[model samples]
Target: MSQTLPDFDQITDTLRALGAESEAAENHGLLCAMLCTMEGVTADAWLDIALSGTGRDALAPEPPEALVTLFDETRRQFDSDEFDFHLLLPHDEAILAVRIEALGHWCQGFLAGLAVGGIQQPESLPGELPEIIQDMLEIARAEGYELEDDGEDEAAYAELVEYLRMGVLLFREEFRRQYAKAGEGSIH
Candidate 1:
């Protein structure tokens, strides 16, 4: 059965309590994306390293049990057929509450996760992933980027988020297909 997704506030609060700077939604997205690129490792294993500061020392902190459950639920949701994944962005009464900087942080965390998973080879990446990844790196560096309060800018931001969501799904499918073609076993 499909499980209820974790509440964003709860997850974010938990991350904050754990001294984590990355938002839960971005963290989950990054982890899932890395999982797609991995050859031999389960989500739990990756989470342990991620929480242990294996890849980046600045992000080191032991996540609370609730945060662990959040990660598990995120993995489960990605593996489900519903594909109802929602980006962990805040929406103002109508406008998206998340700033452009937050998206940058999400992308930053994602690249970090990818590096930790040993999927940083641009030559091995298929499709526009390389370009997107590069773009994400640049976006991660955008500190003072500002968005106009117009509806058009909001639309553009929404489109970008949607593109990222699809990118995650595409990477997952490509990796799974590659694994199948290899006729190898997953490290699950």
Candidate 2:
């Protein structure tokens, strides 16, 4: 697998070509959340959600090879202790509004992924996770922002992204600790 993530636009195009209803950012969010919350989340399971409502079975469509690579690399990043996971969003060059909207979608997808991953009660989760989940819920509900083309919005966006990245890492770590305490095997 490649060390770096696949191009954002390329994954978006592939999703479109595969008739996936979810956008790349949202799909990626779902993938990340599932990886963080669940014990065994396969690419096929992710595709089942990502490709839902398209009237085609995920396997029947034979998702593009790039998508498989994307899943592998993303899983690898999450498994590593290097903190290399990243949200799949538009590059810095994209319009701020577009990026913000995508961020909301990403958060929405993440919440949905938690449900899909069998996290029945996020509020019951240990430590600061419940608060973080609440914050993510608020972010998912955010609609729009009134702002200029100033650097402030860009900086805020960067901060939000970083917060999300760290929050997800924390979730993964906490869950892994729980599993370890329960005498469960590695959550791969």
Candidate 3:
């Protein structure tokens, strides 16, 4: 069904979908922790993989060692902003519009970091690009600009983040469903 924009289940599902790529429950949990509140970041959903400098990208030529460091640093820089960005956004409502825009910045950095040599990702044509890239293309359709296409040609990396964003969007939709019936006289 072409669901309503205000559904609560959908929103929460968007919140959790980003962590699905992790094989380890702990990995998922840990990443999820970054997005959720302290009370929500419990052990049950925590993933073990620590976000650090040594994390490797199976596809990239440049071992993602430094990328890990960049991610941690970026996270620290953005951590405070996430809270303020969402402060006015209700659980089932929209997150900050600017944050959505900033997502492109993060995607650019992530994808650019994964590129090798110069211009274009190592992704070999036809269909090698991840689902995320396609999703980002879909997301970027509105803007109609070449995003994250740095000298490295990390479009595939951009795709990966786009996919993650799409997943998060789905999780958000699911969340809207779960919470649709919560609270009386609700303004959702």
Candidate 4:
């Protein structure tokens, strides 16, 4: 939703040109997760670090401006109240054309990003946060299911995507709450 985010192809190409190791969907998912975990970390800083780190330093050409613009748009979308956070997944047509395992990759990338962003589990999690994270980990390892022409598999996939979407929002809220608590205790 939210006025249609950038297409996966453009993102994939941009990341490829920058010599990023992860694919587009997973890479963006990782960024989103990092944003959630790092609290006040800026998008620009994350991009710089990700691009300049490891095998990416050999890339001669600078990344396209559009890539930065799209990333900023995604950050704005997450901060906006009108939109529900949707995972940067492949479009249905592409998914139907081939068994794209972008969802699992996205989850895997998200977990990696969270870890890299220095996410630390609280001694006690609030609400269903722990379960939600566990579920995402399981989903990261899930195999792609065939989409039956009858639409059953599609329907199931849609539900799973919805769950992923809601989980991200919940995770954001929980992280914020935990951060606020830490800030509060520090001042006391």
lDDT by residue (117-137, candidate 1, tens digit) is: 567485558888788788778
- Error of model 4, residue 73, in angstroms: 1.8
User: What does the lDDT read for residue 95 in candidate 4?
Assistant: 58
Number of colliding residue pairs in each model? 0, 0, 44, 0
lDDT of each: 0.66, 0.85, 0.32, 0.69
User: In candidate 1, what residue range of length 10 has the lowest lDDT sum?
Assistant: 53-62
- Please tell me which predicted candidate would have the highest TM-score against the true structure: 2
Q: How many clashes would you count in candidate 1?
A: 0
The runs of at least 3 residues in candidate 2 whose Cα sits more than 4 Å from the true structure, single-residue gaps closed, are 58-61, 185-188
- Clash-forming residue pairs, model 2: none
Worst 10 residues of 2 by lDDT: 179-188
Q: Model 2, residue 23: what's the lDDT?
A: 90
Stretches of candidate 4 off by over 4 Å are 48-62, 97-100, 122-124, 144-147, 184-188
How high is each candidate's TM-score? 0.77, 0.92, 0.24, 0.82
Tell me how candidate 1 scores on lDDT: 0.66
Task: Mark the regions of model 1 whose C-alpha exceeds 4 Å error after superposition.
Answer: 1-4, 39-44, 53-65, 92-97, 185-188
Candidate 4 lDDT over 48-75, as tens digits, reads: 6556564543554444675666667767
TM-score of 1: 0.77
